[model samples]
Target chain A: AQSVTQLDSQVPVFEEAPVELRCNYSSSVSVYLFWYVQYPNQGLQLLLKYLSGSTLVESINGFEAEFNKSQTSFHLRKPSVHISDTAEYFCAVTISGGYNKLIFGAGTRLAVHP
Target chain B: GAGVSQSPSNKVTEKGKDVELRCDPISGHTALYWYRQSLGQGLEFLIYFQGNSAPDKSGLPSDRFSAERTGGSVSTLTIQRTQQEDSAVYLCASSLLAANPLTNEQFFGPGTRLTVL
Candidate 1:
């Protein structure tokens, strides 16, 4: 079985400040990792993913996450955040195969204050 | 082009009542997924459908939950004997039919918020 953990339930930060959302996973087999964001009253939107290749992955919206194998972590980070960046972030995983369902973390709520 | 759409954006039901949610996936997409998000919680996978094939109902919480996809287009989720614990937003997502499936991105719908009193 595979599971994901997002330790921080809520994070508060000032605008233009850097922030990191921590994620850890426990899996018996290799899995694919993903981060998704959900704005207020909105559906989930994929932020970034680590399928394979480089440990570091980036999204177009200035969010990045690095896959750390030894630590079993995939943490999301942004050097600077805007108020608009405040949202609910989720970390998910799926078995390394075709069209499988994703197991998700409890989610982290990022609140950016102006 | 239209994205995924769901019906009855909000549903209110009594404890013993039943509720049915619908999802219309993106055109020509061959993969569909169902998930549940409880209040202030993350998503829980419920089921998945690929084409007309049988759906993967492994994540369903109980026998009270069932889903069906027809004509490889639309899908419906039915909850029998709903309880307060069943109250949550039901999400539907769809992806393209690819050989590897990893290359496809799953697009989501607004979700149906089911509230059981």
Candidate 2:
């Protein structure tokens, strides 16, 4: 079984400031990690995912997450955040032969203030 | 082309009433999924369908919850004698294939917010 844990419930940062939303997961075998963002009253959109190869993955919106196998973590980060970056972020995991089931964490609400 | 779409964006009903939520997967996508999001359970996978068949229903909370896909495109999730605990945003998503789990990106729907009173 695979599971995710988001360390923060809410993260508030000033505009143009760097922020990190922490996520940790546990699984017996190799797993895929994904980060998804949901804006107010909208569905979740994929920010990025880590399957293989490079441990670092980036999104077009300047958000990046690094998969640290040793730590069993995939924490999302942004060097600089815009007010529009405020949204709910979710970390999800799916292990091999799990029938495409993704177990997600409780999510962290990111709020960027000006 | 349209992304995944769900019907009844918002629903309100008294406890013990039955409800059905609908979903239409993206064109040419062969895999579809259902999820529930709430303050308590967070986001949990309810089920997934490959084509018109559902091979995994392990995520369904109880026997009261069931889903069916028809014509290999649309699906409807039915909750019998809906309880207050069932009140949550029901989400739908679709992917290209069930195999090669890593490459399949599930496109999500806006979700139907069910409110039980």
Which one is best on DockQ? Answer: 2
Q: List the residue pairs that clash in candidate 1.
A: none
lDDT of 2 at B88: 97
Q: List the residue pairs that clash in candidate 2.
A: none
Number of the top lDDT candidate: 2
Q: Compared with the true structure, what per-residue lDDT tens digits does model 2 show for residues A25-98? A: 99999999999999998899999999889999999999999999999999999999999999999999988666
Which CAPRI category fits model 1? medium
Residues A15-113 of candidate 1: C-alpha lDDT, one tens digit per residue: 999999999999988888999999999999989999899999999999999999999999999999999999999999887764667899999999999
Any runs in candidate 1 off by more than 4 Å, and if so which? B98-101
For each candidate, what is the lDDT? 0.91, 0.94
The worst-scoring run of ten residues by lDDT in candidate 2 chain B lies at B97-106
Per-candidate TM vs. native?
Answer: 0.96, 0.98
What digit string (tens of lDDT, one per residue) describes model 1 on residues B1-117? 999999999999999998899999999999899999997656898988988665477889999999999999999999999999999999999888633546667889999999999
TM-score of chain B of 2: 0.97
Question: Per-residue lDDT for B1-117 in model 2, tens only?
Answer: 989999999999999999999999999899999999988999999999999999989899999999999999999999999999999999999999877866589899999999999
